[model samples]
Target: MFVSRLLDFQKTRYARFMNHRVPSNCRYQPTEYEHAANCATHAFWILPSILGSSILYILSDDQWETISAWIYGFGLSSLFIVSTIFHTISWKKRHLRTVEHCLHMFDRMVIYFFIAASYAPWLNLRELGPWASHMRWIIWIMASVGTVYVFFFHERSFGGRDAGAGMREQGRAAMTCFFHMVAPNGKQKAPGVSPKPQTPDSELAAPRPG
Candidate 1:
């Protein structure tokens, strides 16, 4: 029974993740779109620890100041590059505000994690003594604040009225054109762009004679 309940809970969580509709206003460029998603959905949580630990191992000295500076610079540069690429493509594509907002949230969260982890070791170093005591609190506070912001900032538009719906409509138009190019008789035109459905008068109420 316990195993069954756990499986049920996992199914429910997966459903929630999958069903969360990306706001319709978002226009997705295939490249940057995938990059942003990979960063947010997978790498954001893992990369910081990996990079930070690697940096620590490579450095000859374990001094907090030097390590922190290197980590900060590396973190900022990496995030800035990603943000720049994502924003540039998004702007050119005229993506919806919701997409832009979501991207920003993703970037901020990654940066937040990087910054927090970079200082975490300092909070634990024995030599730091009294200062180390406050380090934990500071890191916790910063992380807490960032998490709250990300949760509150996550917003997206969906459905027919969203800004990106026009782009989707255009995509539908292009797909129809492509179909026509490959197969002149193809019936794959946009739904409403095609002829209206016809029904027998018996299937509808007949108009009264004038």
Candidate 2:
């Protein structure tokens, strides 16, 4: 009877703790069965890109272009690899929980590297035009700054300190510009028209003035 009451007390305490607010990073979902599954899922997603891109990069006739391609491919791939490894390292062993938390921060650090790597190649590409040289220097500088900022931010954020006023803002504008440049119809189609301008359905239904 005493044991049952103690068990109930423990359960109640756990329930209360879980119901209480916790930081997102602290609330990791690496509970048992999902640990290996998380790793496997990410591995399967990343491995093919790594293998296929590596082969393509090796065979590309223009080594110069391939360099940039490889950078883009590998930067994103490494994140998957790092995340897979971090998640795979379960904290069920109790002693490893501290290590797992450390790895979580390490994973965030890699994100900074990946973000930088993704843009580093575009800096050297001649096709990017006159501003390419200038943007390259700017990107590298911001990346360096963002990396340091993000690493420290994640550390404090994980420690339950909400001091992330400007967590990893550097290089973001450049990255956004790069993405827009690559996207279809990145420019304004016409003044006052949306990027994906669709004429009114009513106009289509009615006879054209022309």
Using lDDT as the measure, the top candidate is 2
Question: Per-residue lDDT for 74-95 in model 2, tens only?
Answer: 8778889888778767534436
Quote the RMSD, in angstroms, for model 2.
11.0
Q: Residue-wise lDDT of candidate 1 within 1-210, one digit each (tens)? A: 878777663267455333333444553333444455654654354466456646655662435545455655465556655566445545454457677666666665655655554444433332332333455455546555654655564334434233224333333332332222222344322211334587988857877679
- Alpha-carbon runs more than 4 Å astray in model 1: 1-56, 60-78, 121-126, 153-210
Assess the local accuracy of residue 151 in candidate 1 as a C-alpha lDDT between 0 and 100: 59
Clashing pairs in 1: 23-157, 24-157
List the global CA lDDT of all models.
Answer: 0.48, 0.60
| lDDT (C-alpha) at residue 184 in model 1 | 35
